[model samples]
Target: MQKIMLTGATGLLGRTLYKTLVKDFEVVGTGFNRATPPLYQLDLGNQQAVIDFLEQHQPDALIHAAAERKPDVCENEPEQTIALNVAASEFLAKQCAQRDIALIFISTDYVFDGKTPPYLESAQANPLNLYGQSKQRAEQAVLAHSTRHSIIRVPVLYGDVSELAESAVSVIATQISATQTTAHDNWAVRYPTHVEDIAFTLRDLLKRPENLGGIFHISDNQAMSKYDMACIMADILGYPQSLLEPLDEPSQSAARPHDCALADSRLKQLGIAHGREFKEALKSILLTA
Candidate 1:
């Protein structure tokens, strides 16, 4: 079996990726602060440590999934964001390129300005926040280093979480309650995708020889705002939807795109897709959580 090395194995999407990919390929997981016994403890920011880890494993493909994902946190800690998002990623790409290891970099759809509705893989990146800018830089570094690398951009993710607040989508459950009023953003459009679907997409993409080292978009087609999501969660959790209030203006401190609907044309052409109904899937997740 071809060995796969995955970073951020303890994270939301990385956890799912590890679980899904391990079924086919030999997956070696790594984490920094929360790493367990099986998952190697390696800091991506440490150049020598990362180099040593890569040389030790010599994986067929390395999925660089570790990143400072929160826009607010990234905005507050610009240095930390650049170190992890840009520098670490650039280092990994260079190391992977030298070793001839297929590197799959996990990226965010926030790379676009959201002026356009659906962005193709070839769309120019015009990030509006530090978080997006860092990822954009990383994307450029990866592509510059090797054609053997791939970048998979996904939107807001929701999935099996250790806690309710773990994912942006699942965290909506926290804001909702039966007796109290809650407010959510109705202005910014979001495509909340399941992490498992992204994992499955990567699994399928790895099997195909033609599209192994190119840009791909993986996201759910269902478009909804935070208020729309809150309404659905309220219904599922038996909370009154009437208590929910929609804010039709951008309220967050970080500048977010209005709508960045990723058009997965490449995946479509390759007949590679995996998705779930947002309502039903989220019901199962919320109930389980």
Candidate 2:
């Protein structure tokens, strides 16, 4: 079996990917601050530690999923963000290049400002926050260090393993199950991809290793606001629509991307089919959980 080194194995997406990838690959999942499958206490900010880990493992490929995801945290600590997102990625990419290994980096839709809807892979990136800036810099460093790299830019993702899972559709389901009235009235538009879809897509991309040199946008076919997404989740979980509360835009503290949808034409062209619709995906997660 091919050896795959996966970073951020304890994170929401990382856990899901680790579970999916373990079946087919010798997955060595590394955790920065948590424990999960193939767990390693490897902090990416420590260059020598990362180098030692990579040199010892000598995996066939590397999947960089670890990140400082919170925009507010990245904003507060820009230097830390740079260290983890940019410097670590650069080191990993250089190491992978030297070893002739493929590298897959996870990026976010936030790299593009909300002014443009449905950003393409070729679109110019103008990050509005420190988190996005860090990811953008990481992407650049990876591309600069290695040509055998794939950058996947995903939209708002929600599923069982996600940090926002409980607070997302799961929250509504739990509330409805407990007969508690809940309101989800936030008007921020985004294409929320399921974690399962992302995992599957990454696996597919891994199979065709030659397609490892460009950016690809992975997301659902349709777009919806947070309010709309909440309603959909409620309906899927058999919650009454009357219990749903829609909040105005002014209510949110973080600067949101009003229309951060992505066009998955490249993914389709690569013959990687989308897994499920947003609602169907949410229902699957709820049922499985």
Q: Estimate each model's TM-score.
A: 0.99, 0.88
Off by over 4 Å in 1: none
What does the lDDT come to for candidate 1?
0.94
Q: Write one digit per residue (lDDT tens) for candidate 2, span 162-245.
A: 433433445545544326666664666767777778999888888777776878888876667666776776677676677677
Candidate 1, TM-score vs. the true structure?
A: 0.99
**What's model 2's lDDT at 266?**
81
What's model 1's lDDT at 243? 99
Give the Å shift of residue 146 in candidate 1. 0.3
Q: Candidate 2 — which pairs collide?
A: 183-245, 185-246, 185-247
Candidate 1 clash pair list:
none
Q: Residue 79 CA error for candidate 2 (Å)?
A: 3.2
Error of 2 at 87 (Å): 2.3
